[model samples]
Target: RRNDPINDALWDVYIARSTDGGTTFSANVQLNDTSFVTPSNGRLGEYLGLAVDSSNAYVAFTSSISDLPLGDVYFDEIANSDIPEPGSAILIACGVLALLRRRRRK
Candidate 1:
C-alpha cells in the first residue's frame, strides 16, 4: 500500500508475508527499488492488488516516481524456488506446445 498526502511526501510500498494461515504476519518488506516522492496533487488510490501463484507472488500498483512527471503502473514479482529459470521456462513451454501439437495431430 502507498501512503501519500495531498502534497509532496515520501511514498512507500511494502509487502507482508503470512506463514501461519493469516494468524500472524512478518515484518513489512519495502518493494520499491528507489524512493517514491509524491508529486503535486499526486494520489495513488487506496490499496494495491496482489496475486500469488504456486511459486510467485505478484504485486501491482501505481506510483509517481521521482523523475517521471506522471504516475505509472508497476508490477513486481517475487519468485520462490519452484519458479523455473529463463532457460527452463522456455524449454517447458516448448515441450507443452509440442505435446499439444502431437495430440491435435492424433
Candidate 2:
C-alpha cells in the first residue's frame, strides 16, 4: 500500500505474489483509492488487514482517517500446490467450527 497527501490525497493498494519466495515481487496493481470514501479526509490512508485461505489471499483497509464508518475489502486467489500440513488444517477447521457454534448459541 502507498499513499501521499501531497498527491491530491491519493491512496493506492497493490497485490503481489512471489512463487520463488521473497526473491522477487510482481508489479504493483492499483486496487482502490480515496474515491471509495465520500468527502475523503485528503489524508485517507491507514490501518490494513490481510488474510489468506487455502486458495486465496485477501486485503482490507480503511479509506478515512476521521469518523471512519466503513472500509473497503479486496481479495485475490492464486493457484499453487503448496498445501498446509494436515494438523494445521485440522486446527483451523476446528477453530472455525468453534466460532460457528458459539455464534449459534447467541
Candidate 3:
C-alpha cells in the first residue's frame, strides 16, 4: 500500500523485490502507468495479491484510475528475471508470511 509520495492527491502502487535473500531489495517499481487517486473519502476498500510464476509475477488491486467515486480493479505484472536489486532490503509488513533468514556473524 503506497500513497504516492510525490503527489498527495495521486495514489500509486509500488513493489520491491529482493534477490539476495532479503539482504537487499530493488528500488521500488510502479506496477502500472495508470494514474490512480484515492477514493473521494480516501478508503481503498479491498485488494488482493495474485501469484508469481516461474517467469512472471502478478498482482491485482483496487484503484480509482478508471472508476472515480467507487473505484475499480486492476493488475500489474513483471518478469522474474527483470527484477533488479537494491542497496539494502529491510521490508516488514503487518501479515508478512516469511522473511529472509539473516546469517549470524561468526
lDDT per residue, candidate 1, 17-105, as tens digits?
A: 54434454455556677656544665454335556655666767666764567777788786634332220111111001111011113
**Best candidate, TM-score:** 3
Error of 3 at 44 (Å): 3.1
Can you write out model 2's per-residue Cα lDDT over 1-106, one digit (the tens) per residue? 2255454434454544444433544544444534343234433333455455546545555554345565444443333233222101111110011110111135
What lDDT score belongs to each candidate, Candidate 1 first?
Answer: 0.48, 0.37, 0.56
Clashing pairs in 2: none
TM-scores of all predicted structures: 0.56, 0.44, 0.61
Which residue pairs in candidate 3 have backbone atoms (N, alpha carbon, C) closer than 3 angstroms, thus clashing? 24-89
> Which wins on lDDT, candidate 2 or candidate 3?
3
Candidate 2 segments exceeding 4 Å error: 1-8, 33-46, 65-106
Q: Against the hidden true structure, what lDDT does model 1 obtain?
A: 0.48
Error of 1 at 76 (Å): 0.7
When summed lDDT is taken over every stretch of 10 residues in candidate 1, the lowest stretch is 93-102
Q: Write the per-residue lDDT of candidate 3 for residues 26-61, one digit (tens) a residue.
A: 776666576576667666534545455556666676
